[model samples]
Each structure stands twice: as C-alpha cells, then as structure tokens.
Target: METRKSYFFVGVGGSGMMPLAMILAGRGDQVAGSDRALDSGALPAKFADLTAKSVALFPQDGSGISSADQIVVASAAVEATVPDIVAAEAVGAARLSRAELLSQLFNAGVLPIGVAGTSGKSTVTGMIGWILHACGRDPTVMNGAVMKNFVAPQAPFASALVGQGEAFVSEVDESDGSIALYHPKIAVLNNVSLDHKSLEELRALFGTFAGRAVTTVVNVGDAESAALAMSLPRDRLVTFAIDASADLRAENLLPEPFAIGFDLVKGGERHKVRLSVPGRHNVSNALAALGAVRAAGVPLAEAITAIAGFVGLKRRFELVGEAGGVAVIDDFGHNPDKIAATLETLHAFPGRLLVLFQPHGYGPLKVMRRELVAMFAERLAAGDVLVLPDPVYQGGTVNREVTSADIVAEIAATGAQAAHIADRAGAAAHLVALARPGDRIVVMGARDDTLSLLAGDMLGQLS
Candidate 1:
C-alpha cells in the first residue's frame, strides 16, 4: 500500500498556518502539528478549529516528525531553534516557510486570486472569498483572520474554508516580500503605503506583483497604485475606486456608522450595494473585492449582489457585547494608517469614542511611534479616550526605548485623554470600569491575537 503524505506545521495555531493546515486536512491528508501556544493551551482558539476537524495538535516535539516524508510548514515567526525544525531535519523532511508552501501550493491550483497591499489585504481577501462563496462559487480561502462571515456557533473562527471550486484565494503579504512568490490568476492590490518598508521598496514589490498576475486589480485613489496601474500591460489591468474615475466606481454614496451604502458602477451599469462592514476604508475593500470577482469572470451584477451581505472579519470592528449600555469594540489596527482609519470610522457614529490602542510590538512602536502619536492627535474627538498597553514582543529584536508611556505622553501633548496602562488585562479592566451607556469602547491592537480574547473577557466581565 502507498504511504500517506504526512503534513506537520511547526506553528500550527498561527492565524495564517491554521487555515492552511485546515485546507490540507480537508483534502484527506494526514495533518498533524505542534504549537507551544497549543501545548500550553495559552491559545485555546488557535487549535480549536483544527481539533473540531480531528486534526491532531501536539506539543512542539521531535516525536511529531518521525519520517522523512513529513512535509513541514512554518511561518515567518517560526525560529530555527523550534524543536519541530530539529525533528524535521533529523528525519530529512522537506521544510517550507508558510509563504513558500502557500506560494507553491496555491499557484499550482486554478483561479488563485492574490490580494496584496500594505493595508486592507486581509479584509479584501475575506471580502472576495465571502462574495464568491455567497454567489455560489464555493471559493476556498486562506486568510490571516477569523472571518466572522464563515464562523458558526460551532466553528466560531472558520479561518480556512474548504470549497469544491478550483478558486484558491488568499491575501498576499508584502511585508516579508513573499508577495512575489505566487502568480495568481487574478490579483487585487488595494493600495500601497509604507508599513514595514520604504515607498520605493513597496512600489517594487507591488509593481512586480501587478505585472506577474494574469489580471491585476489596482486601486486608483492612491497614486502609488495608479502608477502601478499605468505601468500594467493593456490586457492586465482593472481599476476600482470610490472617489476616483475607474472601471469599478462607487457612486451616490451614503456612509453610515454601521454600513456604507453605495451604487457600484461597472460595465456602464450601476448596481446598488450596501456593505454591512463599517468604515470608508471598507468602501475601498469592497471595490477591490468586486474588481477581483469581475476578474474571476463572475458577472458584475452577481458579484455586487453577493457582496452586500459580508459581515466582516473578527476584530475588524468586532462588537464584543454591550454591557451596561456601553459598546465595546475589538479591532486589529496596529499600524498608524489603520489606527487612524478605524478611529475616523468610529468617530462618525453617534457616541463617545473611547479607544484602547495597544501596540503589537516594540519594533512597530519604534518605527511608527511618531505617526501613531500624530494620528491620535489628529483624529481623536473631544471626550474620546486613548489607552495604550506596551507593545507585544515574542522574542524579537526591538528597541527598548519605545514604550506605551512614551506614546501616552505624546498624545497628551495634543490635549487628548491618553494613558499607558502597561498591562492588557488591566487596560481592559480600566476601559470597562470607565464604560457608560452611549459610549463605544474600542480595543485596538495586532500581532498578539490574544487581544481579541482580552476584548471578550472585558465584555464578559461587563455583562
């Protein structure tokens, strides 16, 4: 009898790797992996979905990799010192980075739509996957977030969706320059901005991504994306924007705190669309999703109809429960631009905005500390609150000088109510204690997925 292929993911509970693991396991492969997060049960969420599927989760150990045929999957965060790497090497198993594995595996499939941008990549990826699934495309998506639209009470965070169709969709990350790896048949790049690298670096990576794909979806409101669109070959580009003149344009817009309702114009016809997901940025996300679906050969009308029902991903403006009439929201907005956008969206709603913004890492704070301070100063309304927990670091090189107190002092200079709580759990308690009816308490952070858990705990406490 032929030996079954064994797949072992080193950091299996990771947001990216978990979905990928689920997809492989759904394909009848012998999928098992190890994660310190799961071993310690520090993240019950990280392994919950896989466990429901009967995908065994093991501790980080050499025992998990006893054969040379085992295919090892790792993320950028996985270190050389991980026991699984040692085990895989001892058995001569093929080691692959999550990006390398995804790029190779995803590119081999049909209708791989790669969504890339400095921001909104994950959102657009989920949006495209949602629209496709709603329109009966049965898209198999690999995302970095738990898409709330796919989640059930049973499967609260359905990250990877196993579908019958050939469309294998995923968000492409340019932070590690892994965007170059996959040649998707359809590519949607929301916008180019400085996040991890310089503008020149972003342009080069995004520019190459546009050129390599069979058809590229570019956002024109952002000049960097426009420049990329201008560079694309005649048969390879489609443009979308809310305020810009493009093939896919959202017109007659009414932006609400709960949803942005607009008419999407495509192929000279206007189709009414309403996005349940809040934010003006989601308008751009919607445009990107529609553009990619069009590239996927879905009818403009069908895609628009399907897109109206997307509820958004978890922690992307997730409403954790209204306790004592105070609305607590959890959002993944670590970067300066994302933080600014989320605040701006929440500010539009009729309520007092209290933002508990946590930095995901010390390195990010050091790199973006100034911009983060400036953003809070600029967008925070009067009566708005800003809370900071120290940046989260999991054994990485980070500047010691950067701290939450540093940001608190800077935001205070702008006359905004900012404070550094130092501890996330304490920060949550502080926010909840201050909560009142008619106020929106937003917990914002990234990298450490536990922020969502913290948000839930805050909500549970409040209720």
Candidate 2:
C-alpha cells in the first residue's frame, strides 16, 4: 500500500505547480503550499479552488512548513532565499523540484503520456485527456491550464483530473530541461521551436524524449518536429500534419471566428473534424492529440469523434465577450510562436487587432527578445495597435536588460503602433480606449491569470 505523504509547494499558485498540488490532494495526500500571488492577494478564485479541495494555502512567509516530515516542492524560479525555502531548510524538510516530484508521480503510473512542445502542449493534453475520458479510459490528466471540457460548477479550475485508470496523461515541460525526467509510454511532440531554450538544445531534448518513449507521436507540419520525427525509429513513430502526407493528416482546413473544421485523413480513411477551438494551430494540436490517443490504442474514428467536443483550455484564444460591436479575447500567447499563431488566427477575420501583451517574465523577454520584436512587427497589421507592460515579477531578482519598452520601440521602428505602459492596468486601459467598433481587443500573456479579469473588465466597460 502506498503511504500518504505530506507535501508543501513553495510556489503553489503557479500554472505548473497548481495542477500537481491538485493531483496530490486528490489522491488523499496531505497537500499544503504557499505562493507570492497568494501573498499579494491575486487570483483569489484559484486559491479558493485549492482550499475547497482540502489543500491548505499559506502566505509565502514560511509559516506553512511546520514539520520535518513534510516534503517541500518548489519550481526552478524559487530562490533559496524564499521564506518557504528558508523555512523548509530550517525545519530539515526534504526538498524536490516541481519537475522531480511530477516526474516521479507520472512515471509511477501504469501508462504515462507526456506531451511536449514549444506551444500547444496544454491544448493537446486537454484534447487527449478528453478523448481518453470519452472513450472510457478514465485517465489522470495534469495540465498547465484549465481544461474547459472538464470544468464543473464545483471545479472551476479543472487543470488536473484524478482517476483510477491506468493511463496518466500530462504535458511535460522542456523549459527547465525537465522534459528529460519523464519516461512515457506515449510521447506526443506537438512542435519543437525556440521558446525557453535554443533550437539546438531543444532538438537534443526533444530527440531524447522521443527516443525514450515506446511510441512517439510527432507533428510533421513543424519543421523542427518533423526533423526530430525523421530521426526516430519508424516503427515507434506516429506522425501527423496539416495538408501533408503523414500517418494522420488534416486537410480541407476551414477557420471560424471561434472554431475550426478540418478533414482528418488516417490510413486512407477520411473523417471530418470540427474543433470548438479556433486557429490552424489547434487543428495541428488536434492532429497531435489524435495521433497520441491512437498510439495509446484508442480507435482513430472514436478519438476523432470525441475530440470534436473539446472546448479548449481557458486562456488559449478564449473569447471573453463581445460588447458594443467590439470583441474581447483572453490568451496565453507569451512566446513568439504562440503570439504569432494568435495573431494569424485573429487576422483571418476582418477586425483590426488591439493587443495588450504582458511578457510572462523578464527572463523570457531577455531570451526571445529579438524573435518577439520580429513577430509583433511582422504580424500586427497596419491598423492594429499593440500595448505592453513590464514583465511579471513575483519577487526574485532578475536581469532587467530586456524591458517591454525595448520591445515596443523595436516594433515601432517597423511602423507598428506600439506603446509601453509599464503598468498592466494602464496598458489595458489604453487598449480599451483604443478599441473601437469592428475591432478586436486581445489580452495576451502567461504566468499571471489576472489578465482574464482584465479582459472581462474591458468587456464590461465597453458595454
């Protein structure tokens, strides 16, 4: 019998941390955690959800660690100087990185599916989880974002679903090289691109990840992922793409304002796939999910049928509401690829974009500064407006070399209407003021969940 363990997470409110905490608490483990966000009183609903699950929440001031038997889990971003960490050290509690603990839990599953990529991992994980559940697999799914399909009145934040079945589905992160920690029965590679790591580093990490899996599901539509797929053993690989020949192919693509339709072709059999989520990127995500569940032994047709009901994650191009002929959207598009995809999806329609993008953090801004500027400069249409605030800073010290102002200036050099507001609310106010009829106001960022509230506020004001 597995003994119940007591665990405390230092950054419990984080996108990655929250789901793991939920999974642990769901399994009858003693779970407690603290977050900088909780201290600042941000995103109360999330904390409330955790509290409702019997997971204790605390201030980041080290009060949560009362016993030495408690295991402290912290993300890589948490410094040793954090009050929680300092407290845990003083209490002689064992410590583990979030990835270390998640990998341990995930690897222990009878069947583990690790979804990896620069983008769409969360969406694809949600799709596969939904499909597996619909097919009666009853998978335990861990994701970074809330799966709308799983959201219930009692469970508003449905990022983690605990089940008794053998299958464990989770999106694995490569940002901290933690993708290497998970050994999955089914590894789904949505795409390999420059996000947190270099292309070279990404290729190596993704290659080894694919190599370790019993069956690798890859997207041939992405150049980097396609190259990775080509290198893997053919017998262990299942590939998918958009408008190209692969094990699973999506053709006859059609984009709607809030949904998409595609023809999924697998093994010379054709089936129409309609996703409640919009964008070509999601079609690729659907293909990757189909490939993954298919590799997991689910019938492709049944998987396709289940996937059509996927409503997508909460912040991935989520339409907040339309008011006074202006549509407001909330999205988690921090990286260049994700931002570009959102821009492309919105541009497919007729509205001019009024974008307010908050960089997730200073570190990512420094890493992808050039690519971000280039993406915004090229993707923002002539009439579109872009606003940015300073990157999210919870507490830790970071290099301030790359600021939002720098990005805005570089993008403005290309004649795009860009501004740096330095405050999120001010930036959002600017976007709301600039938004007009026949325009779409988009709030894009990550790490911080308050952006959704900002979008809703904008919608209310527009009304």
Candidate 3:
C-alpha cells in the first residue's frame, strides 16, 4: 500500500477531503481530484494552493481517473451516480471511502490519536496537533478546519500537516459510522450530543470508539461521555472536566471578550493556561486536549504552555471584520448545541447580536426544529434580532414543513425579535439595515462554503 502512488479524490474541495488530499500530496503521492465548487470556480484560492502542491485538478468528468493502478477516494456523500465513480469503475481503479483511506494511513506504524465527538472535534484535533508540534513531536495532523497557527505564505489552506514523526493526529467523524474504522493509541471524546444521529446510535458508535483505544480520554461534564467512562477500566480511561471531578480538571475560569483563561489541574499540579480563543466551551476542549497530550507522554506543564500559544480554527466564531464599528463574524454553528454555544459566548460580551442564521440543511432543520427555536428564544435578548434565510438546499427532497419561517415564528412568539427573509441576499440586506455602531452582525451556518463569502460581503457593505 505504501507503494501506491496515485490518488483521485471525488470531492477534493470539501473541508474533510481537502486536508487528506493535501496530506497525500505532501507525502509525494500523485493526488488529483474534482469537485463542483472547483469547476464553478467557487474556491479558486484553495484549488490554486492544491495545484501548487502538485495535486492536479480536474472537472467531475471521467478524465481524472486515468489508470487502473490509481486509487479513487470519495466521501460518503458522493453517490455512485457521480461521473467520477463511473469512470473509476470503467478504468478498474481501486475504490475506497474517505474514512477507509484515512484509517489505513492512521493505523499504519504511527501512534494514532483520534479526537471524536458530536462537536469540538475539529478544534480539539487542531489543538492536539499544535501541542504535539510545539513539543517537537513533528506529528502529521489532519483537521477539517484550517489551523491558523500552521498557516504560511505558500500554504494558505493549512488544514493538514505532513510530518516525519511517529505520531499521527486526526479527528474521526461519527456521523456516517466512520468512527468504527479507527484504532487510536489515544482517543479523546470531547462531548456527546444529538446531531447527526439518534442518542442511542451515537452512544453505540462513541462507546465502541472509546473502547477500542489504548487510553481513552473522556469529558466528565458531558453526561453521555461521562456515562461511557463507567464501562471502561480505570487504568485505560482518563477523564477531563470543568464542573465535575475528573483526572484532569479546569477551574478558576475567566472568560474575556475574545479570549479565555483557566487553571488546569492534573496530578496535584495546577498550571494557569489562557487561550486566545474565547468561550467556556473552549476551556473544556482545552482540557480534553491536555488529557490526550498527557496520555501521549507529553509533560503536563509543557502541554499546557504549548496550548497557550494555540491559535484556533477558522469559522469557529471567526471575526471577519469590523466596519463602521459593527463587527461581522462568521461561524459554523448549524446544530442546536453548537448554535447555543456560540450565542452563549457572544452574549457573555456586551454588544447586541444581529444574527443571520441559514439552517445547514432542510433535513437537520426539520429534525431539530423545536430545539433550534427554543435555543434562539432562550438565548436572544429582547433587543437582539434573529434573521433567517431558507435552509441550505443541496438538491435533495426533504420535508419542507419545518421551514425557517416556522422557526422564526416560534422564536417571535417567545417575545424575541425574529424574521425570515427567504434567501441570503434579503437576509443580508435586512441585517445591514438593522446594524448599529456597537452591534455585532453574525453570519452563522454550516455545509455551505458561501457563508464566509457572504459574511465578507456584509462587512464590506457595512463599511
């Protein structure tokens, strides 16, 4: 398998797929792929970077799969109907799911560290990667989001780092049951909640994930993760928490406008650690990182100090720009839990929020409509406004009964100011008109890459 030289990715522009493609290319593999966004020129910068790394780009047509020896890698979202799949079959190319390829690379020789959770997986994975790098571990890290610390002039899209060391760190997803494919030396479960699947399904997936690890690190503050800890042997399980007793505990919490400080306690030693990234949730993520790094044999104090220099991942409450004294923020907060966390962090500061939220997809919106409505109603202050565009449509038939209008109505009934604008352009206009000097205009959603561009446009208009 190490002699395999060529890889063709189906959705090369996707957040998850991009990092893997880059990693393989960095390792001197012949990487080539296609995506709808690439063909439409939606992400020219990303495509250009990939091309510079010697990874060829192609349209979704069958031309990319040239030889029978080339491996075709595709995400679970890519159906068999895609032209790339047809081409691969025609060429007799070996096919593999994205997760299958990742697991094969992860389980090979390297000491794999897998971060898994309903949320915070990307952030925690980036943090662990950064810590390991800072400690001179020279680990190869694959994350879904761009890690700002690793960004360089040549590598603007710094989502993956290819290192010649014994450590390999990556975030494993449980959404499509891919978490079962990984066998990590140290597995970190940040938190467990309802997002992609039912609670029962998540429990089984996450439980198996933790059980397979050599040393499992869990969050005691999260009810589900904490419950899973009970099944693991004490010698094999490590626990971290903010409010509950655990092997690693964070206390003396201090939350600033865009940063947070906390005291990390482990093994009767307390280290004062501060993060440039804001929110109490991040502190929990930091604790999880610390636990995982410590499990990997890094000294507690060294790992804590390395974490102090950690720059957070993009789109996790990323500040786009401040124009006319109004700040425009872009966030990947589509699910109810993630949305609530972002809102809570923003509310900790003084400014009123003018939130323009696009539901990630029609199906997720329908699945979590009531929870989403309740989150908006409970979190938004009286003067704060919540605007909604239609759920992001990606060419699938879904139940349209629980639309953005339904969510807005439910939120408005709870005495919060809310409106549904049908589309992003109208929502942007409404948000611009309502913006004030001290207000924050937050463009929040997921799945759609255009949300960041939309946020930038809003900032320009405000200016």
lDDT of each: 0.84, 0.92, 0.89
Model 1 per-residue lDDT tens digits across residues 1-463? 1225688988787778888888887778888998877777687755776788767877887778888888888887777777888888888999888899788768887788998997898899899999889988898899999888888876776877888897999998987899889888888889887677778888999888888889999999888899888888867888888866898888887888678898878767877888998888999999998889888888878888788888888888888778888888888888877888888888776888878887877766776777788888998889888889887877745567878898899889989998889888888788788888899988888877888788888888888
Candidate 3 residue spans exceeding 4 A from truth: 396-401
- What is candidate 2's local distance difference test score? 0.92
Q: How well does candidate 3 match the true structure in TM-score terms? A: 0.97
In model 3, state the lDDT of residue 386.
91
Residue-level error in angstroms, candidate 3, position 132: 0.5
lDDT by residue (tens digit), candidate 3, 1-463: 3644899999898889999999898887889999989878797988999889888999998888878999999986777878899999998999999999999998884689999998899899999999999999999999999999999999898999999888899999997899999999999999888777888999999999999999999998999999999999999999999956888888989999889998878768788899989998899999989889888999988998899999798888899999999999999888888888998999888888999999987777877887888888888986899999998875534668778998899889999999999979999999999999999998998888789889999999998
Best by lDDT: 2
The order of the candidates by lDDT, greatest first, is: 2, 3, 1
Instruction: Estimate TM-scores for all models.
Output: 0.95, 0.98, 0.97
Among these predictions, the greatest TM-score belongs to 2
